[model samples]
Target: MLERDSPTPLYEQVEALIKKNILNKTWPKGKKIPTEAELMKKFGVSRGTLKRAISNLQKNGYLVQRQGLGTFVQADIEIPLERGLYSFAEYFQAHHIDYSNKILSAKIPKKTSKVIADKLGITINDKYLCLRRLREVEGENIMLIENNINISSAPHIETADFSKESLFSIIERYSKETVEYSETKYSAVGANSEVSSYFSIKKGAPILYQEQLVHLSNNSIIEFARVWIKSNHFTLKTILHRK
Candidate 1:
């Protein structure tokens, strides 16, 4: 149900209509929405317009894409920042939120860059494993994480199956090191073409960027990471305690 003759753009009309349906419980939470073809025919809109509308609805936290599965209504997900050591998987598990991970790459580069070497306290010539993964919540791509880990600490890290395993857990089990704390820096950024493709969002959309250096109990830097989070669907919350 959309207004074609209204001055509002077709995509905006479609977005409003879909959002209304979601808010009114016409499309209940966790239920798959109509197919793109069906929506296009119903709205009498072009494919690009329909996709744009769906993307808008997704960015606003109303819908989720399940890769091969159809898009469905989204539920709330909250990640607490008060804890020093945070794990995305643990949070999802605790909240009982259905989630999945897609590993893009996990390999040891021939040459380590100065920036990565400096952060990990390794020589530029030393080898390190770089892992890139996308985290999906309720079938929606919500965050992209790029982790640079020292190979010397975890020799067989390159061969580890990250799809079903957590990187921090791997380090602890393989390297015999526990994550003590992390020095994190946060910033706001606009999604570039690469990031937009990963999140299926429009280029220049707002994103929350975080750079962190993870350390072991002995105070050795073991991992350096860059995380990009979808701004609309995720929020970073922290509680302050004064000693």
Candidate 2:
């Protein structure tokens, strides 16, 4: 029930109540909420007010609107994003979410983009392995990753099986070096045609983009990586400062 005389806006009150239902599981994930008319009737508010509240919830990750379908509760994944310059392989392990990786491509490229060359401190013609993978969890596509490894320094890496071995470990064993530090640039973007198909999302849907550089203990670059993260379900709790 809304307080007709209260100072807080009616729509804000409605948003809070809806969010509480989501958190408390009163409205379980994927369950569609009532229609605008029904919500207006239930809350004794105008259609405009109900719409405002619903829009607010959607923006804040509490709800998702599907075309031709009523709004539905969304499953939220709040994790430590941009951590240690690695990837979401840890997110699944930490949350106990069952996940699998599909190697899209793992091969040496004949040509390199200047951006990638600059990041790895190598020439455009340098020998490097490009690894592309699609990761899924609980039958939902989650991440697309591309790792550009400077295989020229670790020639034996060309024959290694990434499915059975960790890339970092392989690098260390072959090159006698380990990751000293890393830097990552993060941003939000719209899903491109290639990305939309992989995630089964509409074109231009929100996507999280990241570019990272892993450096060896000697300050030489190990790998330059790029990641495209499926937004909506994932929210970043970004508080970062390394001591």
Best by TM-score: 1
After superposing all C-alphas onto the true structure, candidate 1 shows an RMSD in angstroms of 4.7
What candidate 2 gets wrong by more than 4 Å, as runs, is 1-75, 81-86, 164-166, 240-243
Overlapping backbone residue pairs in candidate 1 total 0
TM-score computed on alpha carbons, candidate 1: 0.77
Q: Model 1, 2-52: lDDT tens per residue?
A: 676779898998999899989999998778999999988988889999999
Off by over 4 Å in 1: 1-14, 17-56, 65-73, 241-243
Which residue pairs does candidate 1 place in steric collision? none
TM-score of each: 0.77, 0.67
What 10-residue stretch in candidate 1 is worst by lDDT? 75-84
**Top model number, lDDT:** 1
| Per-residue lDDT over 43-153 for candidate 2, one digit per residue giving the tens place of the 0 to 100 score | 899988989998878655668777777788876677665465434665666676667888899988889879888888999988788999888755567789898988766
Tell me the TM-score of model 2: 0.67
